[model samples]
Target: MARQRVPEGPPPAPAVQKVSVRYAKRGRLRFSSTRDFQRALERAVRRAGVPMAFSAGFHPHPRISYANAAPTGAASEAEYFQLQLTQQCDLDALRAALDESLPQDMAVLRVVEAAPGALADLLQASVWQLDFEGVTLETITDAVATFMDRAELLVTRMTKSGVREFDVRQAVLASDVVLVRAGDADGRDLVRWTMTIQHTTPAVRPIDVMTGLTELTGLQVPRSPLMTRLAQGILEAGGRVSDPFDA
Candidate 1:
């Protein structure tokens, strides 16, 4: 009997270094779910030729972790994730490769070496922009004032577990109605609002804030406002959100 030849084994994975990256979800891609983005990222990694590490087991997956994913249907400019690489490489080059591999709407914004602490911990609050049509700025301003003055404003939302109630007032650190234009060129009613909310249990969403506004002043916003996450980071002493990469 002829001796059987030895089978070839898989190459060993290299030691990984953690890198934190900031990306944006603009346009229709903002509607993509976290799982959807993850799949896209995995494909981009392969196309970018990133030397990513893998787990040990029957099935190995790329060692990647995400932090503070925005809700679906919400456009965001400050989404973030941590990627593990098999070896140290030029971050700028990696970012460029990945950006080119991804779609136009889902673009990479910044890449930096991660610090010692957890990435999630760096994201303590978020700043959101809500633009409304068919609503007067005065009405929106009054509603915000009322919501801020109140000690407690409870809002209910239907979660997967069941119905839940939380204090929308406590979650909101600060809010104001901004006037992008005194009036539209068409002279239509419009209101631009910005708010900062802390991360808490049963996170308060933009819809919940709208509900609170309606409950407070009985001013019904006819249509859903365009919601966008302007930034997510640690809320500083003066209501400013500090970027995680700066830390």
Candidate 2:
């Protein structure tokens, strides 16, 4: 009988498990600059005393990374952070720990097992809701009117590389006007007429939309104007929405 080698066991699985935390920063925290928010989360995890898996080196740091942070002064409902862990902790415990260290406005909604993929690799597009306070819905509605009717919403942009023409109208996946109530923020009225816009990879920024509108309306944004991400739908290679985090 030929001696059979029971395959020397499967190769050791990757030593790391990545967990993605889906959170939201609201109220005053919305105004937190991206860097500041990162500090806040890091501090919270430390205080929560959760075992943070770190990289190997003389100066090891917790393997925590923030996904594309929200632009300054913009609020967000859908934000993400990836945490590396040596041993899996109860999601409830991790959430509670994070919550305790976080400020009232910053919150941890849920911790989902991250897919065996890179966050950056999975990102395809982002959808945003922009509410213009002290402005009429018609203003945004009209912009949408112009955007929808025109063949292209052309705007010039200056990049680190050089100036380039971006056709935002072509990239827009969705646009609409909606009313927003106050309580979402500080107990203050937040009714603003605003348009929703979605852009895909190699996408157009919101500032471009503002620039195009200003050409006609001459109104400044967020003079109490608030914008937030409604959701970020990840389009997979198969032309389908993929929730890599196993929500």
Predicted model with the maximum lDDT? 1
Q: What is the C-alpha lDDT profile of model 1 across 1-247, one tens digit per residue?
A: 9997643568548656889999999999988999999999999999999999887655679989999899998999999999888899898998999999998899899999989989999999999999888767887888888888989999889988799999988888878787666667767577888999898888888878889878878977778888999999988997889898897
Q: Write the per-residue lDDT of candidate 2 for residues 16-84, one digit (tens) a residue.
A: 566788788887777889889888877887888877776554555777877766777777777888888
Model 1: residues with Cα > 4 Å off, grouped in runs? 1-12
lDDT of 1 at 107: 86
Model 2, runs deviating above 4 Å: 1-16, 157-165, 179-203, 216-224, 236-244
Each prediction's TM-score against the native? 0.91, 0.77
Instruction: For model 2, state the Cα shift of residue 169 in Å.
Output: 1.9
- Identify the candidate with maximal TM-score: 1
